[model samples]
Target: MSRATVLACLVSSSVLALTVAAASPAQAAGVDYVALGDSYSSGVGAPGQSGLCLRSNYSYAAQWATRNSPATFQFLACSGAETDDVLDSQVPAMKSGADLVSITIGGNDAGFAPTVLTCLTSSDATCTAKVNEGKAYVANTLPGKLNATYTAIRNKAPGAKVVVLSYPNIFDTSAALCEMSMTKRKAINSGAQTLDDMIKARATAFGFTFADVRGNFTGHGVCAARPYLNGLTIIPPQNSYHPNANGYTLGYLPALTSAVS
Candidate 1:
């Protein structure tokens, strides 16, 4: 994210925060961590998970808890969560005095999954239009949604070091021959960048750390030599475009660890 964009998001968040009664800093001690967000945080494509939420032990949140042995580690992220879902459902269930919180959100709000499906199953023009739609949502609407979500999180876990992790670009445009056309791939990746930028801006505005995973995911997208994210799938459609177990363990875990450490 650029300085100007970050400044814009900060101004937005500051205005929103001013409207609400200020929350007290969390006084609770010990390692009490909570994970909240959508499928990317919930570990949709990773194995060893169950139920509609698909909470996986292989998720970066779970993996971090396992390695560090926090006093409490609640993996509350669901597969298809939007920002509203986090505010109305997930945040209510979170422990109030959490010392650490991590989230990956905004993609579903931008309608990224459906956009990708359009690219895969529709014409180039249709794909481009859908990608443009997602970009617009990310650029214009997602910041407000993220601000609300981040505000709720700050209220819920005031002292927690909130690490807002970003989504990686799903495709490697450099791939010689991929399933989607080069144009579609580049467009989709561009949209993903827009979404990540919005998320980063808002997260930073709230004084939270923004973990950019795109660098770690380089050469490891859908069509790369060692893909961390899953490509399209038929039997289990929800798994499509989500990170594989390796992505959480390798791509996401290291990012979170570095951010918090």
Candidate 2:
């Protein structure tokens, strides 16, 4: 080769080397992260929602992906999605051997949102009955559903480090909530505990990490001095009970970081 051709080759090699050196260490390892689940994962109240799916850039999955800077990140979780929706829809978006996965589900499957609605819209006696009904669903039905979902996720991402997140109780157990009686609030919170326990067991069975935020949201519940979750969002009712920015950023993100590390 001529001297000019040798110089050109050297410049090309050096440029490629610089480009590779600029890439992050995480990128060198080739991480593929897939975030899947329901409203909480989709980031309903965390702001910058996209499309009708209600995905937010401030979502736990988004935050985690940003901090971790994966090679590729797929956000498939949707608002109001149940365990079945995740099995049928969300898991399809994942690639095999995902490096990291995060999910929050089972609340809708246990009729939690509708049960909370009953407490907000019913008489005290009827609210108690509905809360009890939700409790039964948690104990009798929600587990099997969670197992199917967790199993499906494992099958899809066999090598993934899956992090299963549990829902926090919306109300403080000791207080009379904004719209529901204290008796009804206590029952509903108990049901949430039951739901979390079921999810924890399912995650453990699959060898997945369970990140419980019940303690994090305890003093900052729906009726707390400075609440993280929305309380009775009347103008945009769909946002009710979902976490604000702090809940995902300060609350869920820390728990998830601990699990994955």
Candidate 3:
């Protein structure tokens, strides 16, 4: 080939390569992302799960990692983890060079599991009492526990942009035809809101970003026509009140992506 023709071809090739590289997804920057927290983060209700932790490829964390193609990803969140569990087990796996970290904790710690169970199987008054108990714990005690967990995360992954995710209100009180009493549903949702508010405050105090999934999940609670969260299931009882696969894909995935991006 003539020298002039060869030089022109080389220039075009270089320009094409640069354009393709520039158009790549933001995650191509080699992010080291860690997913830490409890059942919600572990994808309990969603499918593609295994072992005691119930880690699912469908979980928001896994989906995010898959789409972004991060340099490294550790899905350490477990089904029944509390703040203490995070401090003792999950946080230990996190390293200093991590570029991103996401968590969904405090629900199990506030005893939402048993509270919801009570609401599902008991009278409206009884459900209200149990929900009140959870609210009391959230108001008076969960802050300290959350603070400890958040602090440990900051220390472990100093450079990571931590996104603290909040839980969705479990029920749709507005649903016209539903089995759960409106009173019970409202009480349970109120408890979740209280917990979320507290979590947002603590996350902000730590200078971490708080991703509220409630807005994404507003019309998609348990009683909705297309519910993202599971109502109750006897076979795998742990899945109860947790987000379904759609919830992770639609409700949570976007929330985390928005927070990090």
TM agreement with the true structure for every prediction? 0.88, 0.86, 0.89
Predicted candidate 2, C-alpha RMSD: 15.9
Alpha-carbon error at 196 in model 1, in Å? 0.7
Poorly placed runs, candidate 2 (over 4 Å): 1-29, 173-177
lDDT of 1: 0.81
User: Per-residue lDDT of 1-261 in model 1, one digit per residue for the tens?
Assistant: 443443332222110011211122232225788999988898887887688787888888887776677778888999879999999999999999898999998888888767876787789899999999988888888888999999999999898999999999999878898888888988888888888888888888889999999998898899888889887654355667888888887788888888877
- Number of colliding residue pairs in each model: 0, 0, 0
Model 1, C-alpha of 243: deviation from truth (Å): 0.6
Error of 2 at 137 (Å): 1.6
What's the CA error at residue 136 for candidate 1, in Å?
1.1
* Candidate 1 segments exceeding 4 Å error: 1-29
Query: Which of candidates 2 and 3 reaches a greater TM-score?
Result: 3
| TM-score of decoy 2 | 0.86
Candidate 2 collision pairs: none
Worst 10 residues of 2 by lDDT: 13-22
Question: Residue by residue across 236-255, what tens digits does model 2's lDDT show?
Answer: 45567788887787678778
